[model samples]
Target: MNHSVDIVLPWVDEKEPGWRQRRIEYDQGKEIESTNIRFQCWDNLHLWFRSIEKCMPWINRIFLITCGHVPDFLNLDNPKLRFVRHDEYIPKEYLPTFNSNTIEMNIHRIKDLSENFILFSDDVFPLLPIEEEYYFKDDMVGDEAVENIISTGSFTKGLHEQRYAQVNNMFIINKYFKKREVQKKDWNKWYCEDYGDRLDRTRACVYWYDFPGFYDPHMANAMKKSTLARLWELEPDALDAGSRNKFRGASDVTQYLIRYWQICTGDFVPRRTQGKVFFPTIDTYKDVVDAINNKAYQMISFNENCTPDEFEIMKRDINASLEKLFPERSSFEK
Candidate 1:
């Protein structure tokens, strides 16, 4: 906890009108990421800042990455907030990108960013107070290194979607690291009790000398700028390809690739999986509400898949719950 940690929150206010036009103009053919559901605002972003300010007040700074459109409610005057535009950090060639992966892959380029940071999406919200160790310990980041096989469904469409990125990440990871050797070097770390049942998952796949895939936690990502730079040093072309992708393509490696490098290299401290994820379909709408009301997990993520009407209803309920929990205007608010 002696070292400082920052939160990198990349947001999209597509409702701003300019975002859609910019996206359409840039739509050379990236269909997978051009869905409305992908950019929907739940109108609960204020609660996210409130949760951070109240729960993790010791946070050093908040780098709010935007596409030149800041949220009206955000306190631009706040000393802790640093507004970042896509062109500011991302290289000029990767400009006008619609790919979230494209945006994320360049975060290490953000100036004055901490060596240790958590990548928080607009969908993830902390429900409880968290210490710095919750993300990092010593020089290692906190994570559970559970392995998994990419399901057949992942390649069904043959499009380079997120699952495609997972395969691409492992492809590069295996190229750099021999699984048998890494597991042998960090045997205890790989087989730690913190992984619980997932240890068996890794055990099941141990026979393979190469990694198939890392479990996609669908939660916040803890990362380091130096590790990112290391990956760039190791494989500049792979990263450059990812960055040049105006929209996420199958060949484009993700930020998860960096995390995989960290894990395979044993740069992570063991941590128990501590968050819950809800797919916001009508079937699970009630479950999301119950979790919030119960204070179920330390944090939660809503993977949007519901219909427009269903989301409107879910959005209203989510706002109600968060507003009730954090009634006062946080310092991050105007």
Candidate 2:
């Protein structure tokens, strides 16, 4: 709370009347699933804010970045909440975009945003009590880089929106921090060596093999406003190419670009965690419920490919579990 940090979430309502027409135009003969137009919100805003109220009370403010629509149930009068329209921060040309990568590229434009903040997806929620320091230690971002990757199966062979954006993340990191050999000891040594200093070159703190990896973008992600702004200035062409993506394109870069940038520059702490991850399915649903009941993991996420019906079921079950776990209403709610 003393750090003056805020939470930033990028949300969209696929049910918006104008959104469907815009999606058709942006599809450009490509399937919506393949084009990263599949990002949808199932009205999880209510519970998400509840989790924040129960877990992280020290948060300074919450910025809800949207295309145009705001949830009907949202407490717009709450002084702690701010609604940011895409047209407000992003350029006029990038309007009506379906690409989250493009939107993330321009998040730094949010007016009165704090220098240090945490980015959350509408689907990403806190399962247990978390503190502001969990994201920012001494006002610096908390992150880790991973090198040894297990068999994460292949994504769509062609131009998958998320996978392609990850590749761009690696490209941008390499621009600032050239590849270097990081021994097993380097990871541990970094904790004691320099937690506050900036490295002249890339360090072994972040994980990478053929491509650089961060703590994991699917979970709660901490970021710096200045770092992203600096990245735009330093890599204008890269940012330009990504921002121009009106739809999910192969050239889009992941938000991890800033995480890796901080790690390679020696301005981050390596805090890797194995939280409960529930893929979309009836079975994974049970796993998450058990994880929550047993208090096995402090964090949980439902990230997987699913049918429309399955998505609805998953959202319903997940919300039920969340309501059961944290039954109290948050002040942010009406």
Best by lDDT: 1
* Model 2 lowest lDDT segment of ten: 193-202
Q: Which 10 consecutive residues of model 1 have the lowest summed lDDT?
A: 152-161
Q: Against the true structure, whose TM-score is highest? A: 1
Q: For each candidate, what is the lDDT?
A: 0.84, 0.72
Assess every candidate by TM-score: 0.96, 0.85
Off by over 4 Å in 1: 33-35, 154-160
Give per-residue lDDT, candidate 1, residue 66. Answer: 89
RMSD of each: 1.6, 4.8
For 209-282, candidate 1 gives per-residue lDDT tens digits of 78988886878888998998888888889888877887777668887887788899898998776889888787
lDDT of 2 by residue, 1-334 (tens): 3469899988888788787778777776764365342665667678889888877888889999888887887888998999999999998877767778788878898899999888888767677787666688887777655532222356664345666677678767765565453333345634433433322122444444444444354787889999899998898888888788776677777687887777677676666543556666655666766666666676777665667767777767766777787788777777
- Report the number of clashing residue pairs per model: 1, 3
